[model samples]
Target: MSGKYIIMFKDSATPEQIQKYAQDVSSNGGAVHQVYDASIKGFSASIPDAYFQQLQSSLTDSPIAVIEPDGVVTTQ
Candidate 1:
């Protein structure tokens, strides 16, 4: 199942973590369709659902990622 998801990484994360995420998204058959960094907390990325969980695990806190199924989408 291919789809779009918004990943909001944890603020406490290190630079290396963020870099890994950017790299992961590309190699995992996912592209960053959108990115929003209005707040210092973190940024959001539109990618694939496959990478969502990995992102969640990569965070040390309760970082959230918007998961939208194939044809489903929602805005913040």
Candidate 2:
């Protein structure tokens, strides 16, 4: 039940912290697709469902702002 997701960092998150978060994702069996460091201090990755809750809990003291599922948009 793994799915693509976006991990956003807080406004005060430093570049080094962002880098560390990305590495954490990789080490946790997640695939980092893209990193948005300019306007959005965050990254897009695919994380396992089983690890989602654990990741959130582990980042309780981190700069993680939010974790959201990456969804496709449609134009009508």
Candidate 3:
């Protein structure tokens, strides 16, 4: 069940923090493919099913925003 995820950091998050998180994801067997800094602050990564839950929890716990199945918009 490996998939891509879009992780958006808080406006208050620093570059170092984002970098650290990316490194952590890579260390945990996830592949970080793209990083956004202008007009958006986030990174796109491919996470393996084995580490998906853990990685998701890690981001949430760290207060990093995680958006799954990216590129979809819902309007009410």
- Where is the poorest 10-residue window by lDDT in model 1? 62-71
| lDDT of each residue in 9-69, candidate 2, tens digit only | 9999999999987887788888899999888999999987777777788777889999998
How much lDDT does each candidate structure score?
Answer: 0.55, 0.87, 0.80
> How would you encode candidate 1's per-residue C-alpha lDDT over 1-76 as one tens digit per residue?
4455555555565556655666677788776654545563333445555566666565554444333333455899
Tell me which of candidates 1 and 2 scores higher on lDDT: 2
Positional deviation of residue 71's Cα in model 2 after best superposition, in angstroms? 1.2
Number of the candidate with higher TM-score, 1 or 2: 2
Tens digits of lDDT, candidate 3, 1-76: 5788888888888899999878877988888999999988889888777777776667656747656755667999
Query: What is the model-wide C-alpha lDDT for candidate 1?
Result: 0.55
Clashes of each: 0, 0, 0
TM-score of 1: 0.51
- TM-score top scorer: 2
For model 3, give the 10-residue run with minimal summed lDDT.
Answer: 63-72
What is the alpha-carbon lDDT of model 2 when measured against the actual structure?
0.87
Error of 1 at 64 (Å): 6.6
Q: Which sections of candidate 3 miss by over 4 Å?
A: 58-60, 71-76
